[model samples]
Target: MEYGYYPGCSLIGSAHRLNSTTKKIFKRFGHDLKEIPDWHCCGAFEYGNKNELTDFSKSNLKKAHGFCNDIVAPCPACYKNLKEANQDDGGSFSILHPLDVFEYFDIVESIDIKHDLEGRLFTPYYGCVLLRPKETAIKNKDIMENFITRFGGDVDGEKVKDRCCGGNQFFINRWATEKLSRLIIDNTHGDLVVFCPLCHMALKTFSENRKVIYFNDLLLYVMGETDKL
Candidate 1:
């Protein structure tokens, strides 16, 4: 199976680990992820301006569609923007997150789980961008929880899964971002917190007690490819 891959801006910067691990796991699953040629940023959160956001998103979508109809982004922010752009443009192309692509291909059932996390506790953090507006959000939260369990990690139910991480306000208002991050950390009752790149970044900064990791990192560990990550 093959799909158009959009790394987005974060992948090269804060989310480089996610970029490398996702490619490694995809290949192990017998899937090919050809990067969309000349892809641009997904414009993160739009703030209060829609025109500039639409223009930036549309431009990136145009490049992605030029490569393939199915484009998968690893970052939730990128996925949301790409999905919204595709919908607004009435394009036939499909925009999906890396998790969605994995689910579509049913990669979990075939996983070997070389390194099970049986004794560990994990909190699946959704942050904000991943599940907002309903339409673009990940439809099956259980799939992620099940993935954790399949790899031998116990999903903690006490953690607030859909809390906002204040990623958009991180630069604008440090206080708000820290406040939200604290709320998530305070509520979490796990040894480790697993989530997307943005959430991982925010939560890790404010969290001193628990380890925070991207879900891709955990998946790589399960595949026994942690050395590469």
Candidate 2:
């Protein structure tokens, strides 16, 4: 499968690990992630209302329209933006999460990461999108736990998986974000694992003593393609 990837701002800088690990894992699965050339920020936080006119919003929509293929994203913010971009541009292309792509191959037994999470404790945190009503079809939370199981890792299934970590909003809204992060971190028995780079960053910032990782990072670790940092 091929997808037009959007590596949003954060992944290019603080979240570079997401891009590297994502490319490695997707390539291992025989999926091509072609990036859209000259792509810019999708306005990270929120988009203006329809009546409001702005080049950032228009450019974002236009770039998404130009892709004309399935859009895949590793960042939760990127996923939210890409999908919203398509909607803003009249649903020009199908937007898919990399997790969906991973599930597709796993269900067919086409690709398997050579690793396990058994006996290792970690919490899988899904930002707003995973908990929202729209992603119900992907079976987001349960499937994530299942993926951990595939790698022989003991995922603490009892932890709260859908809490908001405030993400980049942490700097802007420290109190709310910190409160949310503390609730999840304290409730989770050990470290945390996440699909979104922003969530990974937020969790790491929230608790330095605790370990936090991206899902793709775990895949690379199990594949023996890289060593623990």
Candidate 3:
């Protein structure tokens, strides 16, 4: 399977690990993630609220349209913004999340686990952008849980997985964002919290003692591709 990939701004910086692991895993699973040319930020989380007419996301979709009709974004905020742009422009391209592509290829069933997690507890956090507004939501709970179990990790079903990490407010009000991160960290029952890049940053920032890792990083560790990210 092949699709145009949009890494967004975070992928090159805070989420670099996610970018590397995602590309590696996709190649290992016989999928190609070709990056879109002239791709820019998808207006991320704050851009949408700041200006509705500018539509920075349209520039990305327009560039992606030159390459392919389908685009996959690893970041939830990017995925949402791109989807919104496609909708507004009435473009033929389909915006997809990474989980959507994984499901399309049935990635979990196709790969063999070289290492097991030894039943370590993990809590999955689906930040706001991934699940809000219903239409753009990826609905990846079952797939994520199945992936964790296949790697021998037990998904903590008790934790509220859909809570927001207060990513947007992180810059506006640091104290409130830290409080929200604390709430998530305090309630999680696991050896480490597994989530997308933004949530990983929030959880990691507020809780110095707790372990927070990206889902792809955890998968890479389970695959024995690297030692403890």
Candidate 4:
């Protein structure tokens, strides 16, 4: 019923829609998401490059455990990082994505019945770090596909769909990312739908009909039509 919410840096800052829509859906599920007090950024992906993995995990684990054992992260980067921390520290806490929270409560009130993506042709985009550490139980591609299907969307299975979106990689090697992005677009051959902000930003430049959207935005659009919380 209650969990410690971690909005991450992107969602709290650039992704305003994510934070607002998340809170709205939480309320609909009768769940309280109290933000971790004095929370710090999860240091999305690149943090471990500088700091020791164990040390970074310890620092974040302290901040998270101080709040609660049930940690819910809205951003894929944050979710992967927090989950990694919990495992590395040998902590008992369980980290879950916000969508998992929504699904757990069976809260459909926040989504509009008519706005479902039943017949839409959409491709999932998983940026770097979404399913990190390479050993976690969660797979970004699978999770996003499950979430899409729950909301009524057809996932393209013609070929391998669980590939990177060439997002952060673009920052360093534009050529590699361009090649990757082109392959991804060519494979999907339609509009791409994704949850990661970085992925959305990257694909926007290459994909002409780029329809990058936060999964939370879709929920918000549906929620707007429902009775206010």
lDDT per residue (tens digit) for residues 160-180 in model 1: 788787766778898998998
The TM-score obtained by model 2 is 0.84
Best by TM-score: 1
Query: lDDT of model 4 at residue 114?
Result: 48
Per-model TM against the reference = 0.92, 0.84, 0.91, 0.79
Better of 1 and 2 by TM-score: 1
Best by lDDT: 1
Ranking by TM-score: 1, 3, 2, 4
Please give, for residues 127-224, the per-residue lDDT of candidate 4 as tens digits. 55555547553433465566567777777633535567677787898887788777777777445756676777677767776466666655654456
Runs with alpha carbons beyond 4 Å of true place in candidate 4: 48-54, 106-112, 132-134, 137-152, 157-160, 222-229
When summed lDDT is taken over every stretch of 10 residues in candidate 4, the lowest stretch is 220-229
Ranking by lDDT: 1, 3, 2, 4
Off by over 4 Å in 2: 46-61, 64-68, 111-113, 133-139, 157-159, 227-229
Where does candidate 4 clash, by residue pair? none
**Tens-place lDDT digits, model 3, residues 1-229:** 7889999888989899889888998887877888998787766665436455237888887787668878888888888878877887886888888787778777777666777887588877776777787878886655677777777788773456777778678888988889888888888767554547778777888887777777787767767787775
Q: Ten-residue segment with the worst summed lDDT in candidate 3?
A: 45-54
Model 2 per-residue lDDT tens digits across residues 1-229: 7778877787789889888888888887777888887877767566565334334534755675656477777776667666665666677677777787777666425434455455787677776765564732234456667766677777762556876777757778888888878887877866687887767777787885888888777767777676662
